[model samples]
Target: MTPGTRIEHDAFGPVEVPAERYWGAQTQRALAVFTIGTEYFPPCLLHAFGLQKMAAARANLRCGALDAERADAIERAAAELSRGRFDADFPLTIWQTGSGTQTNMNANEVVANRANELLGQPRGGKSPVHPNDHVNASQSSNDSFPTVMHIAATLEIQQRLLPALAVLRDSLADRTQAFRGVVKIARTHLMDAVPMTVDQAFDAFTRQVDLGMERVAGTLPRLRVLPQGGTAAGTGLNAPPGFDTAFCEELSRLTATAFVPNPSKFEGMGVHDALVEASGALNTLASSLIKMANDLRLLGSGPRCGLGELRIPDDGLTSSIMPGKRNPTIAEVLVQAGLQVMGNHVTVTMANASGNFELNVAKPLLIHNLLQSIRVLADAVRVFALRLVAGLELNHERLAANVENALLAVTVLNPVLGYDRVAAIVREALASNRGPREAAVSLGLISAEDYDRHVDAAAMAAPHGLSALRQEPSGTSGRG
Candidate 1:
């Protein structure tokens, strides 16, 4: 026998497992076979496995599939696992089986060994509580893994992602209200076009975040529909009748989240459309974050040479060569995170599409990508809001400078001077490198007093002189 290991038997043969660990033969086999990646399933998914195992044990007990003694032991062990007590025992990597069967067996073995220890038996013997027959009663890896995926993802979105998004949205909303009267030059095609309030820009960002929350929330109903009763295949071969409903009820009670059995176990087991839909929503949210982050970076680009319309908060990260230069580190982090979420969505979509007849063979990769996307996005959004958006300061001098220098503000005088006259004044101003007022006065098109009175930059930002502009001939539309 190996000095630091003990012998544990499965259908293959006696296998050597670490003496101090609780996992048995199948887990040890998985550890040796799947040496591909350093990534393991996240703690959330592990906790979800625990919760599902516990709920399944209780449902089995209610259905007369397991005796009270074994069921109680499993429930206790699984509840501990749910609370992260046996985290070390779950050592399988996410790269193991496509069905995540090895991880499921890993959980079963851990729960069984721990339950046996609670019953005053040795850990590796699988006595008094066999890993498969007792600990995993009325369940199969096929059904259990997907159930855990749904549970973990739903909890993550509800507890982490949604709250972070709400906080970000609220922060932007506060900015919108705070800067309502602050006007700045608005650009289209990277050229100054007209004037717009800072609040209007912030309002658009806030609405994007708000709509992202709604989009994510819209996918929850599909996630709550689980396929726990489909064991081995979608035939409910080993699971008891009503086990799906009973398990969902128990799981809902334990998690305080509503869950229901899928109307068709075959469909649920065969495809991951719910997860795909959820990922699509997350992708949409990531796109919005990308746009917001890019806008913030541009708006806060420079204090000396760039836009400089808004001042980004100092994140304590400076450029290596540029002394005393503060970069938009937080916005950059958010943008990178959003980009990663987009890439992970692509992986998830491909993984979900790999489902074969009665089971999707890409279960582990799908859940792993989805969970990673959720975790990174939640963290980035929260930090971006708290560290950057809340501390953003407007550069009033810069806003005024940009607004006063913008030639598009001359469009407001179109109704008074006519298009050709305004066009001539704009061309003269640009050609002479002088202000539009000077150009108009020199061109004898208007006096400086009349130009100032007609060209109200801030008033042009909203509906001003709309009636006069619309009073043109019925067939003639005003030109900018």
Candidate 2:
């Protein structure tokens, strides 16, 4: 009777469950344990569960396991749940209870109970619509849980993560174009090695991100294979002959995403290799993101103390004690997010290895952690693109000054003055604490006008000169 108190169920017969156990007692226990500091629940998983229920109800209707009226009632309830209703009912504490049976039961009970209420029946009444008998009929926790996971993961990758990555990739490409005419010293092993355009650096970042997104995209087709008809042990013992294909087809139609019946129901139901593969792709993308974010942070480190190629926007106070100090907080957040995704990959890996032949007990944690990675990556990409990448300002004056001081500037004059003589000039410039222009003038190896014409930073930074150098014959002398 009381909100948080358990009430007796008549169908399962006199079983007293907590009133707050709307999703059942197991879910209530989980809600208390995995109480991490996340503000929002993973929408992808929620949407997947709702979509699965709708698909399953349709399948049951077609099979005559559920009446048309009840099927319609379940569909309406599922739609409402997908639209953000009954979220509180899906709450579960985050702890490994040997398997994800608790979580699956939570979805079953919530959807079933809600559907019953929508059909003008009492909370636990199964008269017109039964939760387990009709709604979850022909389904086991093993099949349903992983099916939902696969659905959720695929949708999230296609709809959320991929789009965010595209936005970030485009932003990086724009930076590459904008910096095409700006030359900077290319550092190898933290020492200047050659002259390169700032555009080249941004292009490298864009390429890694684009490749990472490709890897992520490549994993989606594999992720669409569902373990639905496998039932308990991948034998389809309880499920009808046509249930697997029909259910998958219905799911595909309902979610508007590809959902194929897995080739090996045993493997699909018992092992989580698909999840491991997907997580691996996410980890790869996250690593690329970390590298890019780190580079941006270092490049924009300080106006006076470090390589100040670009400046980040000041959003909030970076510290409590330091004034006028705006830190690369956005970059820092992106780094942290990438780290979280890597950790999630590790979790999925461990879970995948721990599974046995009949069922993987790690479904709940696997889905939870994988979904966490997807959400974090999607948000991080968006934030970095809009707040950090798009707003980045190049300090042209500083860039030019740094390029002028770099000894690698001798690279351009190597064509006119020869490598041996240019190498001598570079050494002299570094030793005398003077710029290459001043050193060249004092050394008398070059006229002031000749040096200016051959080694101007602006000229060297252009794509034409760089393209020519790239096209040059390796063994040939650098003469016009």
Candidate 3:
């Protein structure tokens, strides 16, 4: 071995590792074999693995399997790792293996070497702190990796994505209440059909995100159940009696999140159904965000030529050649992000589907995509809310003009005056290029008095009962 490097031996034989690195032969071997991507498992996943190792150490000690001094050193090392220290020690890639055994061993080696260092021993020495027999105790990469996936995913949703979505919901709710009285034209099949308060449009988006939040919440129950105890294959071969229970208890104490062992270790090891369900919820959130962004883009289409009911935020970047063309850059970025999230959901689902019996070989892919979706979706929702939603302006003048000038605005009279009569008025309004009231007056479809009574745009935006329709307006001249 070189003066600054050391040789560590595993089942495969000897490997050279850096003198200062806390990782040993397994991690060094993985580094040499997998050069597929630049993306390593993020620090959160590494932190989760650290937490798992610490929990395992405590569980082993509780079961009288690990001596006090050795357990303390391993626990301290793992505790530091869980807090995200020494993340660089885990250099395995997501594409290394579908089962993520390489990263799992990377964690084991790092903790073991760190524990050895704490005991005043050199790194990679298998003496008092053996990676497998001591640090790993009764756990296997199969069980540990999936457990970390569940823990990491649960924390991400609770700490990042859900809170971000709540902020977005608040922004939309504020917009809805603020625009309650602003009437705007509503369309069906992309054709103007009637008038509706701008508030209703915003309300729909609010409800969509609310339901998405509920969908995201639904995933927690399944995610809370983990496969931490099932060693190599669901058999818990080397795990001590009640070890799984103790591990969960220690994990709950450390994380403050209730994590329970799965009753059916077989199912947990054989499939990632919980992750798939959670991905589906994330997919729903993405779809909701896309719809919301598209709606905003449509509303903020143009200041002079298009819908123009709402003005988009001026991002200070115009077309290089379009002179004064502003763009809905925030909304556009959100929609694209949502699309990537949707596609990531499909990747998770596809990976889950390829699961085989006793051990899911596709676990790494499932978690890689799941974590990515959470991060991307959280950022997208936050940016959309702060940049686009908060900056939106209600173009009241343009909105009122569109509502007042449209012929379909007369359709609200369908229940009051009957469809045939309303249709005749709309036809004349469209043919003459005049407002519905003017068309009614010019066509003599109904007296000017009745036209004024039924053409209340605000009332039409939110229609009422037939009693009001039957009650004739004072000084009515249309009954004749």
Best by TM-score: 1
Compose the digit string of candidate 2's lDDT tens values, residues 64-164.
77789888888888877667677767665445454566666677677777777777765555557666776677788888888988988898899899999
Q: Which lDDT tens digits does candidate 3 get at residues 261-292?
A: 99988888889999999999988888888988
lDDT of 2 at 284: 92
lDDT of 2: 0.79
lDDT by residue for model 1 (274-346), tens: 9999999999999999999999999998889999999988988887898998999888899899898899999
TM-score-superior candidate, 2 or 3: 3
Q: Report the alpha-carbon TM-score of model 2 versus the true structure.
A: 0.89
Candidate 1 backbone collisions, by pair: none
> Model 3, residue 85: displacement in angstroms?
1.8
Using lDDT as the measure, which candidate wins? 1
Give me candidate 1's TM-score against the actual structure: 0.95
Ranking by lDDT: 1, 3, 2
User: What value does the lDDT take at residue 282 in candidate 1?
Assistant: 94
Off by over 4 Å in 2: 1-6, 10-13, 18-21, 25-41, 413-421, 441-450, 456-480
Candidate 3: list runs displaced more than 4 Å: 320-324, 463-480
- Per-model TM-score, in order, reads 0.95, 0.89, 0.95
